[model samples]
Target: MKAEKDKIVSLHYTLTDDGGVTLDSSRGREPLSYLHGHGNIIRGLEAALEGNEAGFSSSVQVVPADGYGEYNPQAVFEVPREQFPPNETIQVGMQVQGESPDGVLNFTVLAVNEKGVVLDANHPMAGKNLNFEVEVLEVRDATAQELSHGHVHPHGHDH
Candidate 1:
């Protein structure tokens, strides 16, 4: 089967950054499976995998735009410490969620002091190019339930 819309594609991948640092890998773990043509995987990687079949192996480079997206400096802002839970220990690198007009917003604490707390809402991988070495292991038609859910359902799943 070919990796295409409504198909389940299973693959093992090693992801790296521009500096050759290993970001993630499927070695010693179950190969990742996702529904093709959905938003289950990064856009660039999904695009690269389209039309491929099992046993295909290739290296793909995905720019920030096609991955997490470009980092926006404006996404970083400051809010009063009182906005957080009173008992919560606000610290650098801590992640927090807040409500916005758009919906729930995730922020990473950048700084904490008497002045205020600095938070950055940009995704951690934003602005970084993703390098992926992938080996396609299997490709098959997605189950009807998976198509309806817009994702791949695990084997022996209830849903």
Candidate 2:
């Protein structure tokens, strides 16, 4: 059956960046499955998979706006390491959840120094063009249980 909103969709996908770096793939494994139109995948990908049938394959380029989002310059900040819990080891490239006056946010450590740590709140995929090679393996109407639970169950079994 063709994929439709609220149905179950299963697909194998290979994702890459503009530089041709392989970001992720579903090869040599079970195809990923999820409920359609439930925010289970990126917006651009979900739109591409809509109405697709089993065995359909396509390549698509997803822009920053639809993939992750444009990098926000204001999300970068420098704060003293002492501001964190005593047990935490602050290091560059490490990801941490920071609680601000605004709200809790996930940020990546870009640089570290004796004076402070530099953190960036932008998502890793932000500001990048994504390329996807997707193949629809199956499309089926979602079960009543799955619809009620707001997710697709594997093999139509209870989750």
Candidate 3:
């Protein structure tokens, strides 16, 4: 079967940045599986996978807009240190979840000072172009339950 809306796809991929730094990979692990055209993956990669069949392999480049999205400087802000639980340690690179106008947002700590903590709400991969080397291992029609649940169900299991 070909990858399309509501189909299930399994693929192995190695993701890298523009500088060729390895960002992620499915090597040495099970191939990633997701429902196609349902926003289970990035827009660019999903678009590229459209109409592809199992055993297909290719390298796809995805821009920030189609990936994690362009970085927003306005997403960085400082919050009073006391806002956090007193027992928690405030450290750089730590992720903290908080409520925002749009909904729950995850923020990364950029800096912590005596007065306040600087946080960035941008996704970790925001602003970077991504390169993906993909090999499609399987493609099949999604089960009615899988489609209803918005994800793939492992073999031998029913939900």
Winner by lDDT between candidate 3 and candidate 2: 3
Clashes per prediction? 0, 0, 0
What TM-score does each of the candidates earn? 0.95, 0.90, 0.94
Which segments of model 2 are wrong by more than 4 Å? 100-104, 155-159
Clashing pairs in 3: none
For residues 114-135, write the lDDT of model 1, one tens digit per residue. Answer: 7789999999899999999999
Give the residue spans of candidate 1 off by over 4 A. Answer: none
Candidate 3 lDDT, 34-128, residue by residue in tens: 98988999999999999999999999999999999999999999999999888899899999999969999999999999889999999999999
RMSD versus native structure for model 2 = 2.0
Question: Residue 114, candidate 2: how far off, in angstroms?
Answer: 1.6
What is every candidate's alpha-carbon RMSD to the true fold? 1.1, 2.0, 1.3
Put the candidates in TM-score order, highest first: 1, 3, 2
TM-score of 1: 0.95
Displacement of the residue 14 alpha carbon in candidate 1, Å: 1.2
Please give the lDDT score for candidate 2. Answer: 0.90
Candidate 2 similarity to native, TM-score:
0.90
